[model samples]
Target chain A: AQSVSQHNHHVILSEAASLELGCNYSYGGTVNLFWYVQYPGQHLQLLLKYFSGDPLVKGIKGFEAEFIKSKFSFNLRKPSVQWSDTAEYFCAVNAPLRAGNNRKLIWGLGTSLAVNP
Target chain B: GEEVAQTPKHLVRGEGQKAKLYCAPIKGHSYVFWYQQVLKNEFKFLISFQNENVFDETGMPKERFSAKCLPNSPCSLEIQATKLEDSAVYFCASSQGTLGGQPQHFGDGTRLSIL
Candidate 1:
């Protein structure tokens, strides 16, 4: 079965500090990768996604993720994080369109980040 | 609508009572998905629909959980008999395309609390 793993359960960092959250998935076929962030009391929003193109994808709030096929990893990174950036991040993967009746996303447990102001 | 809209931000239900949730997918979006977010930030996909047709429902319990997306109306998720474990935040999302690569846009979830 396909599975997603987020290495960090929780992380703490100071404002302006660099941030990196690790995500790895186990899937033998082509997959669509996504990183989503949910702020406190807000809806889940897309941070970035990787399909068939460039490995390095940039997202909103200055967040970026790199897809490494050999590593089966798509790690999210930001040069500097603000207090507002504190939220839960989730990594998800799904087989590209061909897998009929199996298009549901396989999600990681998620990483909770706390940024001190 | 520009956004996927979920009605009733919160719902309180007694044990064995019925609970119903609503979701309105964004205009022009043919794919609708429902997910349940429980403790530990775990999200479980419940069901998905493609223009009122069930696309995938393998994740749904099917015993008491039922969903539908009817024409000219919001999609609905209904629980026949609520249990304590049924309490969770339910989210609805929609995408314009049928491909898995299409990004899904989400709505503010509905918080269901069962007593």
Candidate 2:
């Protein structure tokens, strides 16, 4: 079975501090990776995705993630985070599209991030 | 911006009552998905639809859960005889197509509480 794991359950950091959230997936085959963030009282929004090329991907709010195949990890990073960046983050994976059903996402237990100003 | 609309942001039901949730996918999106986020549990895929056809329902509980997507209308998920354990936030999402590498856009989830 394919599964995703997020190491941190909750993280606290001060404003302007660098942030890194760890994510790992257990899948033997090729997989598509994604990071999504949900602010308080808001919908889940895409932070970044890695489909095929470029392991290093940049996304909104100065957030970026690197997909390391050898490490089986896709860690989200930010040089500086703001208080507004406080939100829950989720990592997801989809198996390489085969023939039949390929639309479902396998999600990790979310990590709640709190950035204090 | 791509948007998926979900109705009844909050719902409360009795132990034996039924609960229903609705979702409308963005125009031109062919794939619709439903997920359940229970406390202390990871997000679980409930079902997926492709143009009113059931694509994958393996994650759904066949006994009490049912879903349908009517032509030219929003999709609906119905849970019969709700249990207290059924309490969770249900999310709806849509994507351009189910081919591959398509990121899904999610809607504000409907939080369901069963007493």
Candidate 3:
């Protein structure tokens, strides 16, 4: 069975601090990795996605993720975080070219980050 | 429409009552997916449809859960005799197509509370 793991469940940091949320998946085949953020009282929005090619992909709000196929990890990172960056971050993977028609995104448990202003 | 729309932001139902949720996918999207977020972080895939056709239903609790996506109408998920454990946020997402690595666009989930 394929599963996704997010290392941190809750993280608290001061504003302007660096951020790194670890994400790892168990699928051995090719996959599409994605980072989604959900702010308070808002829906999940795509932060970044890695299909192929470049290993490091940049997303909105100065967020980026590096896809390491060898480690099965697609960790989200931010150099300088803001107070508004406090939210729930989710990591999802979709393997559309796999065996079946089940194109569901296997999601992680999500990481809740709190940035103190 | 460019965003996935879900109606009735919140719903409350009795343990034995039935609960129905609706989702309108993006205008050009061909795939619609349903997921249930239980413990604020854990998400369980319920079902998915590809243009009114059931694409994947392995995750659904067939005995109590039912879903459909008909032409010219919003997709629906209904639970027969809802259980207390059915309380969760149901999220609907849509994508242009299933092929390749198309990113899914999600909607503000419908919070279902079964008392």
- Each candidate: chain B TM-score: 0.97, 0.95, 0.97
Question: Each model's DockQ?
Answer: 0.58, 0.68, 0.61
Scored by lDDT, model 1 comes in at: 0.91
Give the better candidate number (1 or 3) by TM-score. Answer: 3
Off by over 4 Å in 2: A96-101
Tens-digit lDDT track for model 1 on B59-112? 899699999999999999999999999999999999887666888889999999
TM-score of each: 0.96, 0.96, 0.97
Model 2: DockQ score: 0.68
Residue B55, model 2, lDDT: 79
CA shift of B78, model 2, Å = 0.3
Fnat (0 to 1) per candidate:
0.52, 0.72, 0.50
Per-residue error for A92 in candidate 3, Å, reads 0.7
Query: Per-residue CA lDDT of candidate 3, range A1-117, in tens?
Result: 889999999999999999999999998887889999999999999999998899999999999999999999999999999999999999999845345343889999999999999
Worst 10 residues of 1 chain A by lDDT: A95-104
**Weakest lDDT window of 10 consecutive positions for candidate 2 chain A:** A94-103
Cα lDDT, model 2, residue B98? 57
* Model 2, C-alpha of A80: deviation from truth (Å): 0.6
Listed for every candidate in order, the interface RMSD values in angstroms are 2.2, 2.0, 2.1
What residue pairs are clashing in model 1?
none
Residue lDDT tens for model 2, B10-73: 9999998999999999889888999999993479999998889997887899799999999988
